[model samples]
Target chain A: MVFEEINKKDWEAIATYLSGEMNQQEAVDFEKRVAASKENEAYFKQVKTDWEIMENLKQKNTFDTNKAWGNLYNKMEQDGLLDTKSSINKFKLSRLAEIAAIFVVGILLTTLLYYIVSDTTKKNWQVADTYESPEIRTIKLSDGSVVYLNAESKLYFPEAFEGDVRIVEFEGDGFFEISKNPNKPFIIKAKNAEIRVLGTSFNVNTKAGNDRVEVLVETGKVQLTATKNKSIHKVLEPGFIGTLDNNNIKKEINTDINYMAWKTRTFNFEGVPLKKAVEALNRAYNVNIVCNDDRINNIKLVSPFQNKPLDTVIQVLCELEHLKFEKQGNNIVLMPK
Target chain B: MNLILRRIQKGDLKAFESLFKELYSPLCLYANKYLQDKDKAEETVQDIFYGIWKNREKLDIRVSFKSYLYKAVQNNCLQQIQHHLVEDKYKQYVKSEVAHFHSDPAKEMELQEMNEVIEQTLDSLPERCKEIFSMSRFEGLKYREIAEKLEISTKTVEANMGKALQAFRQNLKQYVGVNS
Candidate 1:
């Protein structure tokens, strides 16, 4: 078929070929026709390019659903639209406070509860260590299990394992790379759920105000059970995510694979908006990076920075977007060029 | 929709949060195409969500929640464009709002420039063509899937996608010529 004189069927054929919706015969024919001419090859490349660009834009423009919920929650709170009888309270925490007073209170409550649980349950050797940060903290327990705590996160473990089952409590988010010990099963206690593991590496994230603990397993097998109902449990293997809340326990093959960005610091942003990126970067770096203008968030960054300093990352991002930045007090203020 | 909508109607805030998380990103992106303002787009979607939460008990949706959301965003975006007076002020919406990049800086810049052209070309297509094309391209729907969701035939989806591509090619003729 002539390229310029292509009809509707020809267009369908091309679409199918590009979208991988073609049958074998159609694919062979189309491939042969396109490969026969330089012009055809170029046209095909253009179409492919357009498709790829759209896909990239879709990926990059994906806003944080969690953040979006937080934003909507704020709006609802402002109007008093949230259900008064519901337990899902809105925290309105912006990750940056002069002293993080609410966070401190939360930590205190969590620690107090840890002691109470240890005493009531008749567990031995309870030790709670809270890590607040200018840097991510790596904690090594007596049993050789290592936990990397994100900023403002905490981990409470026993000084020594006194029984066959070892239990630890985690608040906020932490990555655990457990040392393999078959006899001693490891348990993670969070607000709404408990994760039991034989020997595994996983990340547990429990956000404030939301009574849910999200666990993503990196390696090995683990069982996640709701705090209220032990019978409702999910056995999660590697690449699986288990989310336990007051209502239910769910397990799915993880698709949001970049949840480890906080722990790993390996970013893959193709065209993410600046504001969203800053929100995440601020959490990871434990600094205040504010984009005063909403328009600046539209500026996309494709930084795949691995283990880079916050300053260097900010500088590169600013230079790429032609944005100006300077230190203001303890925060970095990004301005339009 | 079945589980969450029921709970939301009964004033379950957590259930409402689940629904919001599922649809927020796509809806915001859809609204942004028309308003060309991220804040406005976000505000528009947020307003709709807030409305849903507030009136959950009396919820009346004829279509699936997914369809209802896309339609709502489309309607809001068109309304914003029609009533929005300061077009020139927001003229830099697409270019200034999004930073486009790939690994190679040169190719990334080219792709970034092409994004504006592609957006313009999309705007020039017929309304239905634009919708079908976007559902396939942005929402990552298969042709048959778009057809089923939009209550159209697969043939129609293919044809509209064709028209969209043909239009894009004609509009970007100059740019393609220089680059390719």
Candidate 2:
């Protein structure tokens, strides 16, 4: 077949057709034209490459606006943009008010139940010591409750469980194995949510910006409630996960034990988002990962590996996903196939 | 610059504060491109600067301040993404086998560079072409949407897109390796 001369209009038409910006009829006509000649096939490939480049370019320019605002706030704080003394005063006053309210409530409850008030004094709780390094630490509570603190995690607890229940506060990711104490329930206070349990094993991850506090139960049953709203309470059974976000509680059946696998260095992921997976790798291995493909960043993966070397992981990923990786010192770069 | 550096080296709170103000937004913006979630991105950026401030006295500014900021932001963002991946992997142990892979870093850089190239190319185009292209692509408006935004007819939108694409392709073909 004789090859027709390709003009600038032809190139634009091909670009539009590939971009899916063309009308239905226009696309169909363009496809027909491409199918008519070998030259058209070659031209289509060229156009396709050009279009991919354009898409890549556009994706790169779009930055997350929310992050920008956060940076500004932090900078202002560091620069002493706000009155430090006033801010500290405000914090102290709010804390004092909270304590006073708790005291008033405690007094009222004490009057109603003298026996419960007396029992509160005998409880012993011990919190884990603070660690300067970002290392996952494990603690065994007095009541035989086991807690695994993620890197940079902090926990606060009393010397021992007292009164009607056992309470502990955590500010980070932690996994718990509560002792079977039906009479004295175990309650974990993490940010805006609370996890209550009666002898159960579960993972509670309350990372910042994660609107919901996630609870994945491995054994027994767990109850999750948003601290801000008592009405939002969810009961979760073994192989179940619950989330409390925006004062809303959502429960979903989850049979995956690997979801709580931070206790082990091995990470088992299934259809996890690329960005999320990268985050996990960095935290687990303390390495930097830079993605060259924005589209791939959102792509999900399904794979399981145990304590694999980072290079091996990257190699397997590249083979399975048809992707490429470039190492620049401590940083690993991810690119498309 | 040397005086500011000396103050930062000495752990002067004021000097650190001033530096934070100057570099915070750009660093955050840079991190946002990698991690799409705004809150997470912000947290990562904040944590980095806070870490720097806490260790300001020991920090060695061996290179341009820009390089140091970029390096810190890059490391933090990458770490955040990798941490999530490990969590997902754990979640997958009992569940069905599925994998989530991140984009290639080289490709991301290439794309960023290409974007810069495209922006320059667009700037060189006629004002009407640039506006139409931005309206159609950036705003994600259909031809009709672009027409409405630009107060032009659908035909004009189509025509302008065509022109813009043609100009872009001609300018970018070499970089994109688009040879027929």
Candidate 3:
């Protein structure tokens, strides 16, 4: 064993190896050689001990005695160590509880700051994007309520809804999502009729002609009144279709769930007959669809379509019935192949 | 020191702090010798001193107060080292199970000599060599960081570190033994 013969290179190698500058494979290989000889291991251990004792330089020279005492004193106070033994443990626990309470309040304030910094609502007084077109449009009112207008429709609304009731007038078809405010109600004046919204709800006035206006309630309650009669009114609940003409108000349980399919482009048909389905599809997509045979009327559909093109829904629908749809004149005809 | 200890036993916080001011750094360094972690070493020493003051009224000590602190800090560090051994660290010192309470008077004398040797060895190095050594060991600056900060090449820093460690090795050669 080479006990007293470590050269300069060996010392430098040990220094770099202990500094962790040497790669893992190099350190492992070096460790194997060092552990093989007792003298080599002792030298390695000596270097390791020297590395540890290096801190003595820091302690003896640079350690701030006053700062260290201040820290220990603070810790002792926190742990109730400075207290006379008679009441030490109790003070320590209360001090810890006080510190914990400060932390909890700090966390709550930080969460509130995050919310204030990243508030999701777009804050502006200027209204944007109002129009009538062949495509759909969405308008966000000042109250955070949204209005979706179908083609051939437009709204007359202010930059911000004013007064106790947020009243917006519109022509043709539009979907109103009135925001909830118990103190202020939302009223829609469309085609000589009014819808008083007491709560936040999704209700679509699918279409409003000179003589008729239709309302379908998706959620919450809406009272539809014919402005011409004043006494003719109906409270429509969810899944109820309320219609107001110049004479009377009519409401019924709406089985045609595809009323919003025009703006949403999503169709949910459950056990609906092909003929009746075609009728609703015509009103929704504004397309002409004809399934002429009475035998095809009993062919019930139980499929759903979301944002699908009219041709895709037709093709899938035909495949399920062993039939096909072809464009014939202005009508898309569904017939047996 | 014994007078201060007697005062501390009578609930004299000022006396306790006087002893703390005198020995805090050395005891922290002593604990670091076993743990190799600065914060844990400081924590062990503070806890030992805190335990003494908290239970001073019921204290029983046959050894000197400094001796008691060294013994307590060593035991705490050994307990921590053993605890980390359960986490599979420091497996190289598995035989450090051999160091649970090795607080003999000879060991204390050897450590006292080693501390003096470290001071002498560090003081004897070149000014730049000592800075590099302290940067690597105390400030935890990498050779690259030290090189950048000092505007020297990394090779110079490494060589200085090597020279400093070698100087201490030569000075403390009296402490290393030929046993397994």
Candidate 4:
């Protein structure tokens, strides 16, 4: 009724508000004006009705659905909208590729983790104290390497092999069976000699007065360098004996099977000299033996001594050589009857 | 979620028709907002949905089907306006100024009056909003930095900042950001 009172500018603002274009403040301001007066309220209703009719006319009069569909279908035929399963197959192929990439990445990660764990296992070592004893001492190293220290020997080994080499300072004797690690070499540091071996079992001995050191190889190889003269070293093979003395260093095929008798206490000597048998017995028992008569040189002992007591072996020797024996403190004197 | 679109991609004509019928008029009206010519707007929308049917198999839409259609119509409208730059009737229409009108002096006087009203409204803002707004905009500090300075959580700062921005929008209709 009072549509004329609501000016054209006011109509545009009302239309803007109807279309959700007015911000909160503008909408509130316009709504307040409508609520204040009956004329403004009637203008609001009229504008809202006009917008509703316009939207309906847009769908009914302007958009002809059938005509548009006909045009779209003709255009589609011209464009050749193909019907096939190729696109589906393409999606499947891409999915397979994704799975394959994930598999390869998984393998790479596992290999990397394995190397990291194994490298750490090999590189880390704990600290331990040094080792020495009078009797034969079997020492298992922190790195699982082992050395058998013989009696009358002083082996001042590192507490743990915390380095790239397994090392020990030696004075008397030892039989070493080191674990096989090519990275960490086993070394014997002696008074007159230095013996180095990489993962092998070997015997080491130093005579009284600290004059000599002997290394006999059993498995793998051994290299003995004279401490007094470094250039004087020998690389001895299995069944080879390397002797390092104050003045000389030499290696020979180990034919003296009794060279291990000090550790084994077992011997098979056939027609060996009287003095030779006594020497084997003395070494096996750690005793001193003196054969004072010249006639005993012609005597020969043809027998096997298998872990026999020292007194029995000596009695057998004295009877066969027609000799008498007297026992001294840690000593035995043999004489012709 | 795009089940109808998937059917359309498989050459289902009925699915395509349902889609076209549901969106046809609304899309035309949206395009007319920028083109200002109902016939051109209808033609643009028909071509877009027609192009959709032509290349249905290659339609790789990540967003909702309706939103994708609306966005495609918007872009096409902008492109047409750019190509026909000499046509001045629809050249100045931007998406942000959807229902704005160029009035003689009445609207200008209204905007001038709006500034005074905003000054009164802004000066009378809630105490908390006034403090948060000055700390953020006037002091030129980041939300997290402001939170740390004020000894509050970042979420509390964000909420207060939203309150302040809402207050500004209530006074200044053209002001944007913080939701822009």
Worst 10 residues of 1 chain B by lDDT: B97-106
Which runs in model 3 stand beyond 4 Å of their true positions? A1-134, A206-210, B1-180
Across A1-337, the per-residue lDDT of candidate 2 in tens digits comes to 1235666577557646754677899888888888897876765665566555565444443443333434544455566643335677887887699787888788677745844543465355445633565566888888988888876677887776666778888876778889998999888888788888889898887763567688888899898988777658988866556878888876655534355555687776656677777877765555688896779898777787797887888788778888999889978899997
* lDDT per residue as tens, model 3, B46-149: 77887887888889887777777777887887788778786654776645743653445346535656777887788899999999887888878888999999
What are the DockQ scores of the candidates, in order? 0.19, 0.12, 0.22, 0.06
User: Considering TM-score, where higher is better, how would the candidates rank from best to worst?
Assistant: 1, 2, 4, 3
lDDT of 1 by residue, A1-337 (tens): 4657767666666767777777899899889998998877887777776766666356545566655665666667667664465333334334346357777788779857765766655444444343534567788888898998887787777777765577888898789998888898898889978888888899898862489888999999989988676568888877667888786986655655357888889876656677768866876777789888878878777777889888789888888888989889988999987
CAPRI tier for the interface of model 1? incorrect
Model 4: what is its DockQ? 0.06
The candidate that achieves the highest TM-score relative to the unseen native structure:
1
Candidate 4 residue-wise lDDT, B123-156, digit = tens: 7888765665556554456666767887887666
Q: List the lowest-lDDT window of 10 residues for candidate 1 chain A.
A: A86-95
Candidate 4 iRMSD, 1 decimal: 16.6
Cα lDDT tens digits for candidate 3, A1-337: 2458777667777777888778889899888879899888877887797786555555664444555666666677677665465576777878799787898788779757644642332242333332424466788887898888776666766566554566666776778888888788887777878888966565555354567888888778898987666568887767667888777887655556577777778777766778877866775665789887888877888788887777788898898878888898989988887
- What's the TM-score of chain B for every model shown? 0.47, 0.57, 0.57, 0.51
Off by over 4 Å in 1: A1-133, A250-257, A326-331, B1-180
